[model samples]
Target: MEQPAASGPPNVAVRAAEKRGYAVSKEQPERPGRPTLDAGRSGGVTVVGDPPRRPHARQRISTTLDLIRANPTGRIALKIFIAIAGALVVTIGIALIPLPGPGWLLVIAGLGIWAVEFHWARRLLGFTRRHVHGWTQWVTRQSLPVRLVLGAVGLVFVATVVWLSLKYSLGIDVVAEVMHYLATH
Candidate 1:
């Protein structure tokens, strides 16, 4: 009798093996207790995550310069107006320093407006950045009782000024006379 063919068609062999409850095995064993890989991580290579990004100081300065350069005449004129208006507001705010309306905020805004165009203003801004946080921290470190007392005093001062302004602007002279007396005597 002729011996069975040692080599047969691959599909036939596969079918025969499957009929016998046998199956082809992969090269490596699948590991347990690990996250499954998806299409983005199909390859065997491991990828490190990227570091966080931060804007550099020079980049900020260059962007500011680019903004200034973009508009030749219009921006310059606008900056001039901002400087003038900011100065006027700051001057009036300073006059009201002993009264109310956030004098320091107006001054800071004035400097900020100038800072858009001037190097000196930029330096001042940098100076304020360095110290303002520390100053605020110091103010907060004061005793709670002291803070309450100071806050009450500031509120009273603000209320007095608002009352005087409303009274005088409405052509009422009594509050103005009282202020004049307080200033002189």
Candidate 2:
């Protein structure tokens, strides 16, 4: 019976040990109370745990606002161009909001464009965010019936505007004439 070679290369022995359910440590010393190879499980790999999550909304908003505010005296043409581009981005973003593509992100960009030109935009953005935040909290507290009624009221208001526009701008006479013709033949 020939004795097996003790070692050829370090990787060969380490791989063999790993296959047989053992870990080959790097140069670092193992921590006390930490299990080595066989005491835990068959795999040689170890998973390091996730870091703790931290809140970052304030940091992000401040950084973004600062970048926008930095160009206060930038060119008018550039500002207009940026606003148009941002509006297009926001339009596309709004369409994608219900599906994907980060609609809120485009809205922020649109606000940033307006913020570059107008104090009202800044105030409006602040008001919108505050109201939105409050409304979200309020909605969670409200009953379903209250939400449904509010939604219906909003829909009716929109429908009334549409109805009035069609009646006045497009003329009720044309509508009636079309209806009369349709009914006749």
Q: Which candidate is the best by TM-score?
A: 1
> What is every candidate's alpha-carbon RMSD to the true fold?
22.1, 16.1
Residues 81-164, model 1: lDDT tens digits: 867886887787676665556877877777877777778988998899779988778779999998899899979887877677
Whole-model lDDT per candidate: 0.62, 0.59
On lDDT, the candidate that comes out on top is 1
Evaluated at residue 67, the lDDT of candidate 1 is 40
Q: What is the alpha-carbon lDDT of model 1 when measured against the actual structure?
A: 0.62
The local lDDT score (0 to 100) that residue 158 gets in candidate 1 is: 79
Query: CA shift at 95, candidate 1, in angstroms?
Result: 9.0
The true-versus-predicted C-alpha distance at residue 164 of model 1, in Å, is 2.5
List where candidate 1 sits over 4 angstroms from the true fold.
1-64, 70-107, 123-134, 172-185
RMSD of 1: 22.1
Q: If scored against the real structure, what TM-score would every candidate get?
A: 0.43, 0.38
For 17-120, candidate 2 gives per-residue lDDT tens digits of 55755444423234333333442644544333444233256544443343334344424555677678767877877765543347767787687667756677
